[model samples]
Target chain A: MLAKRIVPCLDIKDGKTVKGINFVNFRDAGDPVELGAQYSREGADELVYLDITASHEGRKTFTELVKKVAANISIPFTVGGGINELKDVDRLLSAGADKVSINSAALRNPKLIEDIAKNFGSQVCVVAIDANYENNDWICYLNGGRIPTEKHLFQWAAEAESLGAGEILFTSMTHDGVKDGYANEALATLAENLHIPIIASGGAGKMEHFRDTFTLGKADAALAASVFHFGEIGIRDLKHYLREEGINVRL
Target chain B: MDVAIVKYNAGNIYSVNYALKRLGIEATITADPELLNKADKVIFPGVGEAETTMNYLKEQKLDVIIKNLKQPVLGICLGMQLMCRYSEEGDVNCLGIFDTDVKRFIPQKHEDKVPHMGWNTITQVKDGLFNAELENQFVYFVHSYYVPVNEFTAATTEYIHPFSASLHKDNFYATQFHPEKSGSVGEIILNNFLKL
Candidate 1:
């Protein structure tokens, strides 16, 4: 049986991790590489590094950070942010990233997804979408949830899958930092419609939240940040709880 | 010396190269027959349509060159399938390095997914690339087609049915799983191959 993944996301800025209160009032956590290794030992199924800074200096720092993280951690890692072209994908992959996630870039040039998938295989390409409920419909957001797009969540997800996305990482902007729970309504919609694996992101406050996302939302994986980073919940304990709830997890 | 990884329209060669580097061994990716033949060891990795891959190998005359290699050779995933006599994928004939046939896994019910994509434990039947250290370790696998268990089967894993997880004959070694993506256990397997 396939194990339901538990991922710890790190927001990297200028080569260091920055944790915040509601994606603002940021504070330094720790070294990205060391934190990645710690999470791996704690039984994280995989890790995601989102480069929050796309400035010229930040780009160089992010590349080095990826190399350092890859050298330390043995588990599969996905890198996102500033991935606009095929060359960007190649650069990160060569730096030891197992997969590259594209978001705003894909919207600008949908052909980029097809090209990368054709050259490197769909298994290595992931499409990350930040969505929010507006006007009684789920709408897509870009630039780390700062910009809005007219594209509906379901339509974009289906298009991404058809364009050869191996997986879809959907983050609910409304429930992101609230930690009340996942946007089950949005996740359920995407999971029910998409053939590719759907990773539910944002609003993971408690261990039961993960269970609810997997059971109710039917997500393939649940991704969280502060919950796993700040020691509020350990990955091993989370998996133990999920397993107790009859969820299939890697022990 | 760097090992040569055959780069002829194959899948997952970069991962193989990265795995070798993790084990502190350098590797070169090449499609040139002369370059591949002269390397200390050779690896052929693939993940694609069988008939098209076989045709590419035939056109390049690499099928003969690969079979004639004197050094240790490793084939992964589709690369291993191409070494077999024939594959049901697109009804293609292969290099015939191993006396076997590759068959697609047919699910009795609709629930069974075509691609068996995840980690499964292996039961070592005979020592080959794994030695005694990896008798019952789990390796990552992602494929729809598999080679039936046979004399060349060095390790066995069960999915819908028991299938060959690893195969070896003479200097040839192959695995249906992606060792490069299998974490530390996979690194050890690559180290064993490098030492061989």
Candidate 2:
């Protein structure tokens, strides 16, 4: 049986780790490599390092950071943000990323997904969709949820799968940093619509939120940031709680 | 000595290269047959549609080079699938290094997800690739097709049904999961492979 994954996302800026509330008012977390190793020790199934400043800086430091983190940790780590071309993907992979997540890049050039998938294989390529509910419909957001696109969430997800994206990382903007929980309604729709694994991100104040995301949202993985970072919930205890709740977790 | 990772339009080559570096081994990624043959060891790692992968391998003549290699070789995920005799994915024929076929994990009921993604425990370990003390350990897996348990199966895992988690034959070793991502137990496996 495959165990449900518990992921802790690290937001990176200028080679340093930072966390923000609703994508602003950032606070320094720590060195990415150090935090990564700590998370690995704490039993995080995987780690996602998003270079939040990559786009603004017009260059990505994730490659170098991945090299640093991969040296100390054995768990799978995914790097994203400012990944626009095959060379960028190649550089990150060469530097030690197990997977590369593409968001704005995929929206800007849909063909890039197919190209990367063709060159590196789909399983190594992940298309992360930042979604928001507006006007009673799921809309795709770009530029770290600062800009909204006309493309519908389900449509872009299906398109991404067709283009050979191995998995979809869906983050709900509405519930982001709110700690109310993941947007279960939107996640369930994605799970039902896509054949690939869905990673539900954003929200998650408590352990019950994770349970709701997995049970109601039907997500393969639940990704959170602040809760795990601040020690609000330990991964071991959370997994034990989930296991008691009848969720299949690797103990 | 630099390890060579065959880079013929496959998946997860970099992760394997990083894994080698962690084990204190330098690695080079190359599709060049000469560089590959010159390396201390060769690794083939992939994730994708089998037919297209096979086509790419054929185009680069990697199919022949991989089979003729003298050094120890490791394959992961789709790389393992491609090493087999055949794969149901896109109905593609494979390298035939192992006398097994990759088949879809057809769920008898609707609950079975096509892609079996996440961690599962390994049992019946038989190869030196895994530390003897680490039997029945859990490893992460993400794939839609699986190689059925057979004579080459070094380790096995049970999902809806039992399947090969790792397969080993003379000079050839393959894993359905990403050892590079499987944490300490996985590192032990990689270390064992390097020592071999």
The ten-residue window of minimal lDDT in model 2 chain A covers A54-63
Task: Write one digit per residue (lDDT tens) for candidate 1, span B1-196.
Answer: 6699998876567667767777877888988889988899999998777898999999989989998888999999999898899999989989998999999998665334446655667786466688776776767777879999999998898877899998999999999988887777887877778888
lDDT of each: 0.84, 0.86
Candidate 1 per-residue C-alpha lDDT over A104-171 given as tens digits, one digit per residue, 9 for 90 to 100? 99977888889888777777788998888888988898787778988888999899989988788998
Q: Tens digits of per-residue lDDT for model 2 on A116-223?
A: 877877767889999888899989988998899989999999999999898899998889999999999889988888777899998999999999999999998999
Q: Evaluate model 2: give its lDDT.
A: 0.86
What pairs collide in candidate 2? none
- Predictions in order: chain A TM-score: 0.97, 0.96
| Best prediction by TM-score | 2
Categorize the docking of model 1: acceptable
Alpha-carbon TM-score of each model against the true structure? 0.85, 0.87
